[model samples]
Target: MITDPELDGEWDTAERAEPAEPLAPRERAAAAAARPWLWALGGVVVASAVWAGGLYALGDRLAAPTVAYRATKNLCADFKAQSLSGITGDLRKRPVNKEVSHPAVDAAACVMNNVPDSPGDFYVYVNTELHKKADPATEFDVPSVDDLANVGDLRTEEVPDLGERAVMTSWAGEQGLNLKVLDGGAVFNLRVFATTFSEKGGRPATDSNAVQAAMVQDVRELMAALRK
Candidate 1:
């Protein structure tokens, strides 16, 4: 019989081809032992993904609301500090006022003094901040009055029914009272400094009870006006 060259080559190649080697008994057993662990690892990954997704969804739903407080150019106009003045005296003809409007925060500060052209011994400092991209509640708990003022026998107290949370810190002498409130993303800080100087010396003229009450009331009214 005569065979074509191409057909002869094809038959030779087919005869030399070998089958794939099967897994060894030891290798098969190892793979079998690893299967459960691999499956457990995959299950853990999926569970973690689901848990992370749930937290992300919950965070979105519970995130703080956008700042609704409308900060005015003149906080002095928004809050007259009448309650403070009721004890100190009539506020000077013109209370010092400053305003800042920015994308990140809207801020204003007002210094009301009874003495004209001077920092009155008895005066109230008011400041407000409406944060657009941050929540003041996170860092509001850190007390600030001690750092800023001469705090002698400092006393800190919690204020209820005012805002999301509020705190008032009082000191014996020059540092009278510091009231800070966090409502949504808005931060309201009011400080009352009262003192009287005579030939002998100077002593704190502030009535903690009365000043604390007035500060709370003024803060409430100020919060209301800003919300409006």
Candidate 2:
């Protein structure tokens, strides 16, 4: 108590302090160089996420079905008198399937009927073709639909209050009717070509105004099916 280590004079301040270590030039430079690369890598990762988000948002338009089983079945159901031979769907995304007789179709089908001298089944074509708005160059530029009434010498009429807009057409050249409906970004086309082939060559059956009337009714029913 009397000495008290001379009021703490024995405390060694020099022994408690340690010298600061200076980094080598090479190590300092390496750390400094890595900062820019790290920032760039983070930016790249963020950009990739943004791109993927855009694709996700546009998934339906990009991945829209080229053909579908349920779609074909519903279309075929619209026609009751004809015998359905078979149905098929094209699921390809690019370079759409083209046909000389009709606009490029996403699906194909064959139908048969009780027409004498017909060597083979006729056709029941369904196309969920791209709309004029979607591909303005070729979608609605269908030669068959555009000119069949005039070229085939068929009866034609505008169908009122049908699917955005619709047309009912009968082909005297083929003896069947076509109902073309334009809706949104797609054109729903249903056509039947009923021709008989014999020694006289391919010839259309007798014209019937009844067929054209029936097709218009069928198209209305088909619109209901599509809604469901």
Q: Model 2: which ten-residue window has the lowest total lDDT? A: 86-95
> Which tens-of-lDDT digit does each residue in 121-199 have in candidate 1?
6777899998886677778877674545554567778999989999888776524788999987899999887765321
- CA lDDT, every model vs. true structure: 0.79, 0.50
Residue 91, model 2: lDDT of 14
Models 1 onward score TM values of 0.74, 0.40
For model 1, which pairs clash?
none
| Candidate 2 local lDDT, residue 55 | 93
Clashes of each: 0, 0
